[model samples]
Target: MTCPKPRLQALLSAWNAPQRSNAGFSRVPSTLRKLHGTAKCAEEAIDTSTRRHKVIFSGIQPTGIPHLGNYFGALANWVKLQRNAAPEDELLFSVVGWHALTLPQDPKALQQARMDMMALLLAVGIDPKRSIVFHQDHIQNHTELAWILSCITPTGKLRRMTTWKTRLAVSRNANDESEVDDSLLNTGLFTYPVLQAADILAYKATHVPVGDDQQQHLELTRDIAEGFNRAYKTPSRLFPLPEYMTTPSKRILSLKDPSAKMSKSAVDPNSRIVLTDTPAQIKSKIRGATTDSIQGITYDPVARPGTSNLLSILAACTDDDVLEVAKRYHNRNHGDLKADVTEVVEETFRKPRAEFERLRGETEYLTQIAEEGAAKARSRSDATLREVRHRVGLA
Candidate 1:
């Protein structure tokens, strides 16, 4: 199926349009906003002003093969950000292998997962040439920066982070839930946010594209940067607190459990739509997806999570408004909506699967891409690290 070019165009225009900020950062001019309003004029506006912005940094962990939640929520936003970025603007996308180690993992499997994720990112339109795509561990400076930032980052700050708490709550076995204590949590998991702060500040990224779920982490990144700056009495702020750019698509939910976000770690494999899922698999999963006994299709997330989830998936895939999509299928039975959604999903993923298969074969080429990107990333990151170290009196 063809992508909705109009929606893509609008997204690109919004991304490229100069951001209005009262906080001393640069602002997009009014002229640019006017140009962005008209689709016909957006291309020229982007071509004209694409060279003025600075750098952007965002990372994703190599946990498992990415799914629809991964794509629409994060990776697809990366593609649009890269396309809209000016020539001078640096775009760094890292497969944060180090962060993945916070949880128990098999060494060999983690390595393979990293490579698979890099290939998947490239297949989904993150251009290696246009954007610096690399493995985070390859750049020694990320760890160096993390260490320096950790010094200024209070232990209390790490304890307050929600992700670790949420993960711990989820991972507790029924029998073990009551027995678990704060002492049992690993230091790596506790310090995960500090390392994430380093990942952004190391690149001095002015903008970070993240989903709503990550807003808290980004706020902590800002707090860390500000804390370090104040403590060091630096001539200028060492790092810009990056702005959050939410993805356009609504969060995708699980087919099996509509209440939860679609996760690779979900107990049921059918709960997610993996980028690598075959057409038949896509159809089968959607066919068996849980929807209530509602006679007509409607988007009521609270009252009818299952049908609402189906509507959300269809809307995201087709670039139609969820409410509008519900109206179109208002008179239709749930079966018709499910079948149509399945067809759209299958068609949408067909080319992506083909591209992923082709790229997976070129292991050597993929390795080169990662290595080269890592080298470039290191050069930029080391400069920031050196400045940070000197400021902290480590030099």
Candidate 2:
């Protein structure tokens, strides 16, 4: 009934998102054509960032509720990247259920969460027509590729990754996994990096939009791709190492505890604002948000984390840089700062929340979208996997 956002039409066409133009190609195959400033895609093409077609892949796991941390950290950033992308780019957003299994989950809750996340993606402006949005488990190709890649990936490298506790982002001290004793770390948690590498190389994605926390995982993906290339080359190479396309969004911390990243798993309801929170809930959470007794606003992350987090949230909502937003609040009190942050966040989540509620209950509609997404994803990865098998002498 209504026209899509200008960026939605533009996002699927490019990677690292250059500039959007009028023309866009269809969804891509694994071997995609040259992509520039677009969300379009083709198949049986190489994944290279050097003036060729661009394939951008990013994954989200359905572990629990989708919070602002997930939004600013990954989801919102993906949409931003999509909008600015060249028309030739291919954007693949996967609901990575397999990755969620790294931590134990109740089956029923996890299933609902998967749908909730899918709905949230669409609600937040990921168009099924433009980008390939599918559940990771729906297409077996990801796991198959993961198995092949795991053979080449080293255990030392897996052990070395700092963000292994949570595959997405690290909330604790960057250098310390020592807080959690060694025994609690599961095998899936240990090797999920290999799976993550597989997720990228499966479609031969060129650029991944991620926060700084997952930088090591991206490096590992490139390493595994190089290893696969070294092990098995079809003609010259089978895989083009993907690059990291960093987003401008920063990591949002918890309202209750500024020391940690905002989380869905946090027991306190007021600790993090869910994407689905009502206006009253958002306002209440912001009002109760942990801020220093210190006067006047500043953007010092270390000295004023609570205050800084508020500034970061406001900046992200307004699409302004954190420091620039801080300048606006220099002479203001915490109360004034909170009120504005609350107003903007409520504005930010407004339409998406309403859309999510409408779509979440539409089981048939959701299934249809998932099925189409899976079909598109499978078609793209089929080419890459066949080449992988042939080079490995499995075919």
Candidate 3:
């Protein structure tokens, strides 16, 4: 792999100098400054690391059966990462139950959803022997570390976050900004970034994969790590600011409304395709997808978002470039494009869907995997937390 530029390398070298105990914004390198508030900075940060500890951590909410967006945007990238990662690298995937609690949930439903999510992860090829998979709530250290990191996280930074603000605005249907106040939001939603920071820090994860929408949260995670290292003034930093890896799949849009992302919360069931959907259901949904009256097929996102979304899905499923796929369909009609998309979707998900169904019945197997994975996760996180507590005078 290629290394970072010499200037960036020099700055990072100085940043990690043993004699330099001061940690402040003014000391941040110009290279980092040029890339600040972006995922590239985090990527560059990791590229400069001389250490070989490549720890990967990621999480998903156990909201229910994952939709197409979840499969393509996250699960697929996870499987790819596991297959390609080095032998010594550690990868942790979590069914983040604590994150799911940001919204009200039925206890019984949540329990079943957690198990189902675990089974799905295994079914999709996340091998228990190769990668660690667990429910976030099972390992208590995640919350413990989050509380410690929260002490150094600034309230102003959390307030400036757009995610919670936009979510609140949408939930209240607030016409103006004044209507969407802090009272309408929960503390869990507001401080969720700190919990996420702890999730990475607890593992001392060197790499984290997230969607573009969550890049800001990763930046916040970096800030929290720097703040902790600065405040404690330990011999060496306890945490390594985790870098962000871009997901392989592009953002999948809603079938019904291309303007919005594919989500489970969409009112129309047909708006999103779940992994469990049968071939017939997939065909029906694709056939009913909204497209323009344009005669010939071409890749024009602005002019024809619906058709462009179908083409994007095909490209993702077939592991081809969108432009290349679009070229082949230049002479075809909308029906021809939809037909091809349906076929690819069925072929891609057929095995995984069958595996998911079969694994859903193996409750004991899933339980064992989760228990073993949680134990492994706890062992590593406990040691990190113990050292963090001692450094901060909390031990």
Candidate 4:
């Protein structure tokens, strides 16, 4: 029996769909015979199995001039990544000024700090041409995308974040979480991870170079991407799952308290080495650094943290292995090791310090570079925002 004309057309349309695209025409129902025979051969392509050099996205807060920990842990890796980047590779290095504002900050000081940070990044070899280096606030899309991601993110996840908990413990005089009311813990601090995820996904970054401490946040970024993709059911992956690129260096420890990481927030100024430290300041800090009355120097982080910390710093600065550095000072006393580490640090920071001084003097040039970088960043971010908006039905 012959099928009705309308039924035939319906069958034809169904047969033309992708599910039946691969079926042999002879086996297709007669109603879809004409449609099946007219189909083009499926594109035969080889799965090259080569991995794409993923886009790398990393950011630093515009707190102040970066300390030695910041230099060795993050900025140094950023320079190496950018220098070796392929033509197709994408890299974004942002000065996260908004993230800096989660805590109370003086307006004028924050502004100055942001400008100083941009110059320092340039002096440290973050080429604006190779990587998109800009202030986070300049690209409004970051906040816009962050708001959207926050909507879909579970409150439990934010509440469980280690960073907020650590900050609260250090800042609050009260013992329990209830003592510090919601006012003290602002929405910005609580939802900062979502914003961080937005920063990566906004650029569709596929690889992130971060310290072990930041691996948790990168995992959160992946979850956000997967959740958004599953929710929207997009044809293609909306965001690439970012992989972490870790450096071999262990966390740089404080000079004053070798147990703790070198941090800008340390109560003692001598605890951490600032990138802009003068030769005199470096010498004084090294001279006064806390070290036990140990007879010999060896790399023992657990037993003699002070000497070990110095050795680690030396190894990082000179790009030598820690074990090898320890062997160099195998039977030496603490004084010899400390003096050697101090010298290496001074020599390593010398060129960057000079560049920073030159860049700081040329304020006009620095301003121009920041503006140009911000403009380029904004253009790329705007495109991503448009696609995201369309996906979420905002468009």
Comparing 2 and 3 by lDDT, which wins?
A: 3
Candidate 1: clashing pairs of residues:
18-28, 50-86
TM-score ranking of the models: 3, 1, 2, 4
Q: What is each predicted model's overall lDDT from 0 to 1? A: 0.79, 0.80, 0.83, 0.76
Per-residue lDDT of model 1, residues 222-316, tens digit only? 77876886788567667765656667788999999899889887879999999989878888999999899868888999999989998988877
State every prediction's TM-score relative to the real structure: 0.86, 0.84, 0.88, 0.84
Query: Residues 1-395, candidate 4, lDDT per residue (tens digit)?
Result: 24324523322342234321212211223312232243331111111113465578899998867888889899887887776667888889998998998888999999888888888899999998888888888888999999999989999888778787566555543457555656667778898999999988888876778887887788788778768877876765566566566755667888998987887877789998898898889988887777788787788999988888888888777666688878878788877777666776776687789888888777788788878878988887788888888889999
**Total residue pair clashes for candidate 3:** 0
Taking all chains together, the TM-score of candidate 4 against the true structure is 0.84
Candidate topping TM-score: 3
Candidate 3 residue pairs that clash: none
lDDT of 2 at 185: 69
Residue 185, model 3, lDDT: 81
Off by over 4 Å in 2: 1-49, 165-181
Which is the winner by TM-score between candidate 3 and candidate 4?
Answer: 3
The digit string of per-residue lDDT tens for model 2 on 185-284 reads 6788889889888889889887787677788788788678767876776477767766556666778999999998887767688989988899999999
In the range 17-78, model 3's lDDT, one tens digit per residue, is 43321122122344355447665654545342456757999999998798888898899888
